[model samples]
Target: MNESSSRRLELVPGGVQLGTGPWQRPTSPSWVLVLPQTVGLCSSDLKEVRRSRDVRSDFGHEMVGLVHSSSMDDFPPGLRVCLDPHVPVTRTTAFSETTLLEGSPDQLRAALPTVLDGTPDDRAAFTEPLACAVNCAGKVLAGSDVAIVGAGTAGVLLAVLLRLKGCQVTLVNRSPERLTALSSTALLREVPKVLISEVGTRTFSTVVVTTASLDDTTFDGAWRLLSRTGGRLVLFGGIRSDWRVPGTHVLLDGIRRGEDVRELELGGRRALVVGTHGATGADFAAAGAVLAAPLPWTAGHIEELIVGRVTLPGLAALLNDAVRTGVDPIGKHMVDIGLNQ
Candidate 1:
């Protein structure tokens, strides 16, 4: 394959288009990285394509690649960097390897106090998702009993991180298979107490919902699991617009009874309702710190979370499979863009 050639999986009117093109390279000041097709198979990537109006949009954002070339003085060739796809509005640089360059002078000054003393590449490709999980976990108070409503990659990672913070975690999912997969993770097993259940009836102090398929039943189930006054619920998943739950039951039993049923509070015990958004630079930095530290989970447990690895050439096929079956491979799917793959 030609290094200069462009390869993309475009969404056409009826289906997807995967092929090569003579697409123009980045201009002089802009940098280019050869993101392997492997990154596009993530659940987040699939969700973007499903919601996009234009099928021809670029889909893979959580990607890591060697710097092909750059006109910027700060970034040079052969440096491994992960792209911060969501560059903040106030950013001066177009992109950074791991963190976004926040536009505000005060925010930049705040970051000065926490910058990690490591090279960009030391933060691996998985840093984005890990950072997001870490940020969400931070929102929960220590020792709070937490229930995560999805068993996807982010949900599982969040469960582990919350456990690290001393929270008892009960992973709730529609699929028993995902719970089985979670039980196999050594990281998850090391937690003080972890209960995996397809059925959630008991109320908890806090619940984090992070699944894509949130319907009436899901909402009902989540509301049923919150404590009356101090219960908090955080929505990390993108809920469909068509979803609706009868407010009568929740209002009469939950709020009316003083079971607050409120949003999540990060630093305090207050409940907080989080909007669905991509991770930020601060989130990325926090995730790096966790990944850099040694995980207490066993190797087999970590391996159980890895579903499979595919080369760039096989990405389009894997995505098509995900859409068709509505079931992803057991855990996480990694793509290898390097020549060795």
Candidate 2:
């Protein structure tokens, strides 16, 4: 196969720097080269890029593209597909939209339905994050009162997904604009929106700290917002410190960024990180099917949540905010690789 080249989203000190690079296909059978049609922006993409502006990050998971080539029979040229970067075979960096993506056959087999049917390319682009929404929110049972902190893409997504499961959600964030975006969303229109100040006085059975930015205060606040002795707190975006939860909280399962929380002697409360378990082929398949026929909010939610569409060269300002640490970035921002170029 001839070597391919494409634009890369290089993380610089303040924002993203775009440059061209060769798209090399590794000598792995499960991997296939894909040219993304549309890549959905994720808050996690911001976190990884913002991990250090000095570093480069290609962290795009939400995209739908055509298979450029594949050694595997299941994935062939002209086949339309999405990616699951968490699949062990797909753990490389920077494979979102507009660039050449190395995809996973296991993910194709397990996650998506046959032939990217029904959904449009733009709507189908939500496959990966919707899969993530399923992974995180599917854990909570119906009828639970849930509080999702951060109001970013993931947090907003969790709100929609959890509500689909019959849970009542209270979406909280510090940014009024982000809250405004939520209020206008097709899926979250009925779900209540609350400022951070409003949550301390109330409680929930499950609290998903799915925020991509501002991990500290929300982390402590989410713990306080969780109600009942056995309530669950699932941290998806991750926390920085080892802050202790004095009483009535217990570490159930997940990655621990806390000190004494890991050694707690409690019996009822459950606090664990949902992302601790890596994405599997099953996850990918379920994600694909969900996008094809997403229930409750469905693919229509993708239409309402998509705030902007920009080509590679025009992504500077949006991506800069995307990677900003504390600033809450709005809904899904897609990158059009301008493949026609």
Candidate 3:
């Protein structure tokens, strides 16, 4: 891609920049060039850009785009794809006007192809994260009472998916704005939600923590919300690297490894702990289907989660503001690549 139209979000000291540059074409025919249409701005990306002193690799995953150039027959130049970078494809960077996907035809087709061909870019972009929630939901037994700590996008999506599967879901968060935003949605209007301090005397068969805001108090709240006997705890969010949880070594280790942990005893309380990270190819495919055709009980389409949309340069400013002020904006922010271009 030429320098004029090839803009990307670059990490610089204290913030980010929307820089223009040329992209060299890959020599291998296996590489497919994609023009990103929309990308979901994840908190992890903002956190990394905030801490970095120099430009690093792309942090923009959770994207949907059209195949701009491809030698493969299956993925033609105009075909659309939703990429989950964790699916193991090489050179898969999403935070740019142009990105490359490297893999064999079969591999690329299996991992990148989507059922969301005509779906709007904003909705299709949710494939990656919803797939993650799908992966997390697969671990829980249907119809079991479940509580999700943290009402961020991840927690809200988890609550919707679990509720659709017949599980009773209660979403908990410390922030009222997030909960209020969720309630405004048509699908989750009636879903149960409470503050971390308001989860009084309530317990569930399963509890999932979906935010990185967990500390001693929040962690203790999550633990207390579990049913005393045979309850399962799913750690879906990674703990902040700077914080350490003592006396919960087993659970912490499993979270770090992204693997399941056995039952653990905490002050004579016990619950089976399970950890989940990235999504698989099958999970992506399922997520695409869920977004493309919202089931009757799905409450609302994935597009409802988008709270703000900005262009590449606008995204740079948003990151800088978050880093400078040390506070993150609520809800999902989508980067509209085609805006003001």
For candidate 2, the per-residue lDDT at 136 reads 70
Question: What TM-score, to 2 decimals, does candidate 1 have?
Answer: 0.75
- Candidate with top TM-score is 3
Per-prediction TM-score: 0.75, 0.78, 0.91
- Give the per-residue lDDT digits (tens) of candidate 2, residues 199-224: 55687877777665334466667777
On the 0 to 100 scale, the lDDT of residue 301 in model 1 is 29
- Report lDDT per candidate: 0.55, 0.62, 0.78
**Comparison by TM-score, 2 against 3, better one:** 3
Instruction: Give the candidates in order of TM-score, highest first.
Output: 3, 2, 1
**In order, what is each prediction's RMSD in angstroms?**
7.0, 4.8, 2.7
Clashing pairs in 2: 12-53, 58-94, 110-285, 111-284, 111-285
Q: Candidate 1: worst 10 consecutive residues by lDDT?
A: 91-100
lDDT of 1 by residue, 111-183 (tens): 2222234423222546666766776776678999888887787887788788778888887777576666656
**Cα deviation of 316, candidate 3, in Å:** 0.5
Q: What is the lDDT ranking, best to worst?
A: 3, 2, 1
Error of 1 at 114 (Å): 15
